[model samples]
Target: MIRIVLADDQAVVRDGLSMLLGAADDLDVVATASDGSAAVDAVVRWTPDVALVDLRMPGLDGAQVTAEVGRQAPDVRVLILTTYADDDAVLPALRAGAAGYLTKDTTGEALCSAIRTVAAGGSVLDAAVQQRLVALVGPPVPAPEPDIPDGLTTREVDTLRLVAQGLSNQQVATRLVVSEATVKTHVNHLISKLAVDGRPALVAWAWRHGVVH
Candidate 1:
């Protein structure tokens, strides 16, 4: 079974998620937290496969909890399940090493699938969240932008575009009609070539360089 820790400030939200996720045969709702600190504590104690966390919690907030979990329990994956889908909220958590981001409006099946995906070391972003990411990245600039970074081939550029759009490696592979390993290779190469830390940083670089308007 896939172990999970659900964290939300609302008691009702936690209860609802517990009930919903608990009913799944392959999932176990190991524990629940009403705040970010407690969420990190639970993760450290339980070392669950995934921690479904909220963005707006007292004490630490989602990004703080994500970073803490990364420090204390690096093997555990964090998947943001929150009401906020804006870039301000999403980007920080992603930079903190969150495996995925999803809004509260996602269906139960999608949420479970996302948790499983994260457990399997895959990233996820809700369609609404992806749209907001693209729309809120930055103000549009004029065309004929700066030159592309050196050593990024055409395929790598395509992969980077999809990554900035919040697509997972598997999704990018499907979109490019290539293998997932190939997509990961492109991502790693771009991260090295662009000098960014991770996917969130890559997205920020894309905006700054006019790669994604």
Candidate 2:
């Protein structure tokens, strides 16, 4: 069974989530909290497989609780289940190590599925949350035809430009809201496609080809 601690300030929300989650044969609502501090307490006390947290609460808030849970009980995963999906609400919780994010409007089945996913050490983001993250990274700049050298993808071009501008792999990952491993993959592909030896050569090639001016 996937154990869960449901936390939300509203009693109705808490009760509703409890019922919805309890109905799933594979899920168990081990505990429930009506505030953030209580939520964290329940999590630390129960060490459940997943903590389904609300974004805003009286004491700690979802992001703060996520960070605390990560520090105190690293084995437990956090999944944000809140009404808010704005940039300000979503980014901090994600950065604080939330394994999943879903709005309250999510169907009961979807929420249960997300909980299972998080418990299994995977990540999930609601469609609205995903869109917000994409918007934060901004759209890929369209390079004019013929100006797109080496047939690189738009994302690769973006990576190349950032790399040419002296961004490290980690920094590029932060700017693009992706993983460092992903950034490294892009860099490797760029080197192979452009016949560059390494980063310095890539930078030189980018400058020479007017990819980053």
Candidate 3:
């Protein structure tokens, strides 16, 4: 089972998400916190496999919790579960070593999938959020091939195509018969070459320019 920690200030949201997620057979909501500081405490105490944190909590906030988790509980994967999906918060969260991010508007199934994805050592940034990052960083360059994108290794392109299709890293790894770490390297490389700062950007650029076929 995937062990998880929930950290959002809203009682209704926390309760709803906890109930929804806990119902999944493969998931376990090991602990819940109302804010960032409590999230940190939960990490130190419970050491769950995944932490779903809100970006705007009192005291510590999502980014700070992510950073602390990175330092103090290196084994734990942090996934930002927030309402905002703009660059102002995205960069800091990623820089803090958050493995993935998703909007609070995400469906419960999607949110559960994101937690599992992060726990399995894969990225789970929402596609819309990814586009926002690209807009903030710079304009996306149209791929030369339209159909035949470049800059990434052929394998990297394949990995990105799967990502665009909304497959998790674990799913991609299983499909490709490669390790998840290898898929992650391909993803990072794809992000660098496309100048698409995040998953949403990649999806937008690929759809607009026809990179994935």
Candidate 4:
């Protein structure tokens, strides 16, 4: 079963989300929070597989809760739930290590599926969110980008592009015709050179600076 914790200042929203998720056979709404700090505390205590968060909560907010949870328990993936998809909320949420973002209006089915996807180490970039990522990232400019970093081989660049295209680690290895271990090595090297900690950062960096193109 996928354990979940929900954090939203609004009681109605929390109740709705909890009921929606609880109806799923494979999902358990272990707890719910009315504030960001409580969300952070619950995440550390229960260590849910995923957290559904509201970006505008009074204390700490979604970004801070996500960051704190990531620092204290990185295994608990964060999924931001906001009323709007604006950059004001989206970019900061992603930077804080949230695995996905969803608006309040999403269907029960979609929300449940997103939880499953994020729990399995995948992001749910809604169509609007995908465009937001590209827009906020600006554009590609390869010139003078990280010196192509000393350790990255030509094959690694191909691999990086695939990653920027949203492929999982296993998918990257298969696409590059190499073992997962090889892909892990390349990815580790890339992160060290670029100084990024997660896929969202790597993707934004590669897309914005033309590193992967």
Candidate 5:
């Protein structure tokens, strides 16, 4: 089972999430906290696989809690579950070591899946949150140099740019006027050529290498 520590200031939200997560056979709510400090305490005390945290709470807030958990219990993955998806809220949590970001509007199934993904050392960004991040970063503007790095094909470069912009594979496919499977193929090629572990690393690599501005 994937052990979880749920943290939300609202009692109703905490109760709802507890019930929702309790329904999953592979998920168990090992602890719950009503504030950011308590959330950090719970995570440190229980060392759950994932900490489902709210964006705003008294004492520390989600980002602070994430940072604390990273410091106190490095094995715990922090997943931000909040009502706000704006840049101000999303960016800090990510910067502070959150492995996933999902708005409260996410379906219970998706929430559980995100928890599992985070616990498994994967990152999860809600579709809406991804769009917000993409918009905040803006579209890619290629550098003036003509030669591509790593001998990447023009199509692979295109895929890398879109992926760096935080577009999902399906969204990238639609933007490129290609099939989703084709986009996935391009992504796989990019991952291999760029030597990145996954999509999140791809985004970081793109920014670091100026693949996307």
Candidate 6:
């Protein structure tokens, strides 16, 4: 089962999430916290596989809790479950080590899938969140020369560009007229060539290097 800790200041939200996630046969709501500090404490105490954290709380915010978890329990993946998908809210949590993010409007099944994905060392950004992120990140400031990574094939660069635009592998495949497996292979290659962690990191690199602008 995927062990989880839920942190949200609103009691109703906490309870609703608890019931919703608990109903999933493969998920266990191991603990719940009402504030950021408590969320960190619960994560440290329970060492759950995933922590569902809110963006705003009294003692510590989502970004703070994510940072604390990264420091105190690096193995525990954090998934930001928040109402806000604004760039200001999403970027910090992600930079602070959150593995995935989802708006509260996410369907119950999709939320569970996100939790499982995070626990399995994958990252997810809600479609809305992804769009907000790109808009917020904005077009990169033009440099004298684009800092393209060396040794990347043209196809890999094309894949990277699509990924930077927040397209999923399937979408990228369709756009490129390639198989999904081919897109995945190109993504893996780009990740290695860029020396980044995952899709998020790859997107960050693309933004920094003006690859997507």
**Top of the candidates by lDDT:** 6
Evaluated against the true structure, the overall lDDT of model 1 is 0.85
lDDT of 4 by residue, 1-213 (tens): 999999999998898888888899999999999999999999999999999888998889898998899899998999998887765778888888898888777888988988898898776656466557767867666576543556678887777788777676677878888997788778777777779766666777777766544
Clash list (residue pairs), candidate 1: none
Candidate 3: pairs in clash:
127-200, 130-200, 130-201, 131-201
**lDDT digits (tens) for residues 115-176 of candidate 3:** 87788877787877766655665654566665545455778777877887668777888999
Q: Give the TM-score of candidate 5.
A: 0.73
lDDT of each: 0.85, 0.81, 0.81, 0.81, 0.82, 0.86
Model 5 C-alpha lDDT versus the unseen true structure:
0.82
Candidate 3 stretches greater than 4 Å from native: 142-152, 164-166, 173-213
Runs with alpha carbons beyond 4 Å of true place in candidate 4: 104-110, 122-124, 142-150, 173-184, 211-213
For model 1, the stretches where C-alpha displacement exceeds 4 angstroms are 131-137, 144-147, 207-213
Give the alpha carbon lDDT tens digit for every residue of 1-213 in model 6.
999999999999999999999999999999999999999999999999999999989999999999999999999999998887774867878879888889988999999988887787657888777666656656566797667967999899889889877676777889999998899899889888778766776787787777866
Query: Model 2 Cα displacement at 188 (Å)?
Result: 15
Which ten-residue region of model 2 has the weakest summed lDDT?
A: 137-146
RMSD in order of candidates = 2.6, 10.2, 3.8, 3.4, 6.0, 4.1
- Provide TM-scores for the models: 0.85, 0.68, 0.78, 0.78, 0.73, 0.78
Give the winner by lDDT: 1 or 4.
1
Which model scores highest in TM-score? 1
Which residue pairs come into collision in candidate 5?
Answer: none
